[model samples]
Target: MDHPASSRAGVIVSAPGRRASLRLSYANAAAWGLGNGLVSSTLVIYLGLELGAKNTALAAALILSAPQFLGLLRFSAPALIDRLADRKTFCVGCYAASALLLLLLPWAAAPGRLATPERSLVAMVAIWSLYHLLEYLGTVTLWSWLADLVPGRIRGAFIGHRERWLLVGTIVGMVATGIGTYLWRSHIENSATWNPGDRWLGYAAYALLGALAMLAATIPLMRMATVTTTASRPADHVRRRLAELLAPLGDARYWHLLLFGCTIAFFNGLTQSIQFLYPAAVLGLSLFAMLTLRSTMRLGQIAISPTMGRLADRFGNRPVMIACQAIVATGPAFYLLATSQAPWFVAGAWLAWIAYAGLNVCLPNLMIKLATPHLRAAYIAAYFAITGLTYGLATVVGGWLVDTFRDERFYAFGTTQIWGIYDLMFFLGWIGRTGSVVLLFMVIEPGAKPLSQLLRGEPQDATK
Candidate 1:
């Protein structure tokens, strides 16, 4: 004898429930960002310097490819969540798994314990792959779970608020990691009591602490389950659920959006291959300087997210996306110009961050908007899978290109010069991204206002 209200779809109708959910969401995002920031900035430094992975291309390929490759498995999440019939349990499991996997990563890279150098590298990659797989799983499930909780009309404001707090966590985490690493390095260098050969022990210690923080962050998410609705509807049969996975591919509109997303992912993978190496290898910047530069980028995101969100709500996600693509197209060229100077690279990071923040906010919102409520999870999965496969391969290709021309340099007119490997990458990436901007015009969001109306700053009164 279920009540009619209880049989209806799960939606938070009361102000108190929504407020409680929002608070928990903010707390979870901040804690998760803090954990990520602490370890993310350290990965490249620890691998390339501490582990003596001097083959830049190999290191970059391994680091960037893991996530993209594993992201394809996101297709399984929706079906799995349906079968399990509990998004909260699945998400918490992922969070716990990520913490354990991250803590276990350092052990795989332990220098002398391995039989050979090659074996150590292999072990590191395998461990990191597991860690990234869990990370993506957690992200995919969490997004779907949270999307169900948010009321449609207020989604823009809520996402903006969450992103702001997330950036704050990231800023604080970056500063702590940077300053902490610098001091640790200094202590090891100066202390007669410390062994130089054991410097990697410091990375392991920090990773353990970060892992603990990741687990601690789940407290908020767990508490939120009691106050919020984590399930959308009942599960379907395996065959029926499997058939629904193809629905996104069948829908012309969803297909176009997926293509648009995949295009961006391809170009991003190209640039991400060198994101860490270009600054570190070319400019010889230290960990502290790199993290400081990243913190500046986060500061920009924090400042711009609110405006971007409101604009998306007012105009449309399509226009915001177009503007973001235009800005993103300029990023690689900016990096090309940064060949010899730290300030040039800093400027590039700032510009890229601002553009990326807008895209980050709008793209997901648009995807959710386009998707039918029952199939939203599957739609998100399809988007990630298509993009992930293409992006993963592109990343490996970028790595190969860099390795081919690492020692080669091209001299220009008079005293002007360029590092051959990175220069080619930046220039080519610029061309690809610039060309991709045209695809946005082809995407038709049915609910979005016309481009002319958006340009005129007219609100779409029709948008629900």
Candidate 2:
């Protein structure tokens, strides 16, 4: 029988065992990120440009936002894990199933495979939704599992380390996609003998690779050791389970974090569709250029993630998050400068997005820190559900606004063509983002030092 080793926090695993498990976890994150970067990063462009999706704005928004919408299914993770009593099995099973489902996306979108482009889009959406549902369930369980596996003291560093590898993998995958798509568009698509019906073949090849990468991710996860969950007493009854699920809401600190999360999610999502649509449709950026921009952002994340994690560890997650949020809110301003003649100006926007690395590392750390150890899964589920739904709704609303104003132009002083729908959306998004900082202020991170002190080189509190 395997006995639990002692640790200050989280499930006890011996030092050597914990180190080995974390190494495997890092590998899993890298492989998973590679798959995500290949498929999720390129799907919108593939749909709009290759698959001929109609209602471009709404379709792009739906494609981008659908996964978050399906994040509602994450709420089922806790109970399912409890019933299964094996998070590793649940996570592996979900990931494997999702990968298998993802393999059908190319078939669903292939021309002549479905009767019409509309039908193809519908099929793609259905497949994508189901894929994300399973992926989200797996993600929730994985986070819960990691919450117990990684000790609190090093949680920030561990997240940052894993994220760095994940970003590295994403960067590699995106670079490959850029190169492949560039070659395809230049040689294959423009070739005299190329068939219009086969436009999706290039994208389909990448999708296949992405699916395989996702399946490969499961291998590392399988090697990681399982730890006992903190859910001491099982809630067998429906009422008890429901109550347990709802318990996170009763915690004031977690509630504040939830509000901050919802606010950020909404603001960040407000221009989701146009972010892709404007570049591809209006500015005429190639898939290669867009992927390059995304890779640039990931590279930035790779550079800053470790520093952010250290800051969070020394000061607190909130201080780092606050600073990062402020920087990220400035991103839309950069987008506002990009015009058809100066599309490269959008590079600044991508650079500004680098700040998200801090939030990505810190936010989850804070969430797990605030949650009750035994109920971490429930708290995580609630966080994802509420924030994901908010983001999806915001994206849909933004899409509607874009569709409604696609033909109209707005003037600032009645003499200048000051704004198009995309511009308007970007400005509004920036405003919402700037305003959302207020919610961040409302969040209470225990044992956190003030940002000013951290900047002043003051020693961190020993107890923290």
Candidate 3:
């Protein structure tokens, strides 16, 4: 039996035990990433498009955004974690349950008496939403659990190392799935003996394999040391509990971080659906081709994640975050340049997105660093809730704009043809993203040097 701890502030395990836990954590990240890549947005969008659900922008938007919208459920996680008091059990149970739901996805899209194309699309969205809800809760608990397991001084390096493994797993899974799907489609198209509907069988195979990988991810958690919560009391009053849940709002520095995060999330989501639709619908990119692009992005992430993490540790997360955010904001310009005639321009967009690796590593490190140890879960949950809701709302609104102006076109000087709804949304996304950088300046990270000083290799001030 595992011993119970009073608080989850620092490394609670022995050095040997900590080493073992880190190894298991790396394994968990790998398996989880494999599962994630197998059931990625590329596959979901492809499945929806195959079901004839892309006739409207709203459907595609929901297919991509609805599951993320369920991130609002993260707010419930702190209370649930407190009630359960066993982060590992809550995380493992949620992951296992979510993985099981993947089995239903292929059937949800398969033709049947009860399933029309429209109905199948709705079912797919419903299933994914529930899956994400469970997964999101598990993620909250897992992060809170990890905060105690890893030391703060080397947190950046640890996250970077784990991120590299995660990317490796994702790249392998995506490439394999892409190759499998490509060959399967090729066979169905050429062979007279195969039923075209048999293509759904391929999806079933992917779902089963992905589910197994996700289940495998939980096994590592079972081996790791358990971190028990002591912050909440069983006899605490309802009103007091409510106040505790809302406590993060009283933190001014965390509030600034929240503002920056939400702003960035909204802009990033504003053109989320179009990112997939334009490549597939307008440019006629194949599933394999799209997956290849994603793999390339992951490869870039793998290359830079460790370096970015070290830079964050050396120069502070804020400076690295500011630089990466600026680079990522330019991504939409590449999308704007891509036409059916020159679809390769989209490759630049993916390349520009490689900078997101830095932001991903730094953002969470900062969040974990900022939160009070006991109330860490609540702080994380609040960040996810506000940012996620903003993102979902932006996606839905952007989709509505696309649907509302599907046929409309505009021009700057009435001679040069500005594209339709897509161009407009992409331009707005660029503007929103670029403008949001100002907010990052307001985010206070003590001892964090300015980007200028970091670039100049200046030493940190004695007082910071």
Candidate 4:
């Protein structure tokens, strides 16, 4: 029943060493990446390589769309998570379940004599979607904990530091995964040419490593600080619920922040939808090449995430976020020109990746500060829903763009059109993200005053 200010203000907490937080976040990020690299990156390859799903474009859309279903389930998860006394339980439990499901997925890859290959593939996709759903539910809940525990005064630094560490974990997990996948791909799966046995073996290897990382990741969350639940009065719960749903729009300032954030996410969705397509098409990279490029991009996130976090904490989340979006929006032009140069395309990809990481790390801190105390869960859930919904549909549009002009040779058009709707994505994505920037500057400004100030029906902050 206590507000964040009342509960958190006098709490004696040490700003832990960068080392400790980084290590924990790294371990956590690694567990997911190891599993994700296998589940997401590898399974995607598996669909094409093993199941022989020739509808790569459709398959891509379906995979990206998985989160929409997950988000739908997560619509209520924030409510439940906030009520649960132990975040570690939900976070670790969800991750463990996802890992277990992933390990069992090899069975879903191919049909036995009893189950047809088509049936098996469908089952595999279903299981994978379940995994995404679990991940979405677990992750949003787990992340809200950081907002709860870390003091907003130091949040940007802490989160940035955490992100950098996690990026390290991601890099380590991804690099190891890429090498293993490459080895398995070349020896067993045969990327240039396909082999079913090699694929089964490769998938198993990926699953085993993913399981191991999951186990390791689970350790820290179990060992980490717990969020002890507080009791709520019945009337208070109802009042809170009403407040939660409307808080984001209760103020003109928040209207801008939320508007800007959602806009940015809309663009990000469009860009991320085709993130894989660029390297695969414009640069003509293979699956291994795709993984390697992505891993390489994580290196930038590792280096800059903490810095951006610190900047967010010091300079404020809005400015840092603006910078982040600018960097993200502008990076695509480099990719457009790097069509002939693989390394340049990778560099552009890395820059975009780094910008996205910075934006993500900082934006959460901004929201944590802006959220109504009784309604924190609502704010978090709303953000995810907005982003997830955009991402789901973005993939379909992104796929259509690519497929529509996929085979249109540049020479035929006076220059090879940069692979389908790549140019349009760059343009549209920037437009959407820039909308965020304009909304933020014209509307929201950081003025530290209690929510009670607004609740008292005081005049709003400057937005003109």
On lDDT, the candidate that comes out on top is 2
User: Which residue pairs in candidate 4 have backbone atoms (N, alpha carbon, C) closer than 3 angstroms, thus clashing?
Assistant: 410-415, 410-416
lDDT of 4 by residue, 1-464 (tens): 22323245323223443234445665777666655555454335444345555445545556566656567666666556547635567777787787677666665654362255556656665777787777777776776666656655666777776676666666666666667666776775445567555555655566567666766677767656554435353667556556665666676766676677666655665666466656654566665666666677778777788788766554556666666777776665655556554445556646575777777686676666666544565666677766677667776666666667666634324656434466666657656655566665554546533335544644333211
Q: Give per-residue lDDT, candidate 2, residue 195.
A: 76
**Stretches of candidate 2 exceeding 4 Å from the true structure:** 1-4, 7-10, 229-231, 234-236, 413-417, 450-464
> In candidate 2, what residue range of length 10 has the lowest lDDT sum?
1-10
Instruction: Write candidate 3's Cα lDDT for 1-464 as tens digits.
Output: 23443233543565556668889999999999998878787787777777765465777788778977888888888778757747888988899899998768887877662447888888988998888889989988888888787776677888898898888888888988889888998999889897766776665567668878888899998998875444445576566568767888988998899988888888878899888878888898987888899999999999999999888788788877888888889888888888999999988888888999998898888888777776778888888888888888888887788888999988944778777888888888888898878888889876676767877987333221
Off by over 4 Å in 1: 1-14, 41-45, 192-195, 226-236, 340-346, 409-419, 461-464
Q: Global lDDT for candidate 4?
A: 0.61
- Rank candidates by TM-score, best first: 2, 3, 1, 4
| Least well predicted 10-residue stretch by lDDT in candidate 4 | 9-18
Compute the lDDT of residue 218 as modeled in candidate 2: 96
In terms of lDDT, which candidate is stronger, 1 or 4?
1
lDDT at position 104, candidate 4: 62
Candidate 1 residue pairs in clash (backbone atoms < 3 Å): none
True-vs-predicted CA distance for residue 11, candidate 1, Å: 3.6
Q: What's the C-alpha lDDT at position 206 in model 4? A: 64
Q: Write the per-residue lDDT of candidate 1 for residues 1-464, one digit (tens) a residue.
A: 21222211354335555467679989988987787777773454455356665576657776777667877888888878766747778888888888887877678667876886567766776767777777777777777776767666667767777888788887887788778877887899899887776777766666667777788888888877432443454355776687768878888888777777888788878877687777777766667777887888888888988788887777777888888888878878878777554446546745575777788788777777877766777877888778988888888888887887788888643456545878778778888888888989888775777778777878754244
- Candidate 4: regions farther than 4 A off: 1-6, 9-26, 42-49, 82-86, 111-121, 189-197, 229-232, 235-243, 249-251, 271-273, 340-346, 404-427, 430-436, 443-445, 448-464
Q: Model 3 residue 221 lDDT?
A: 84
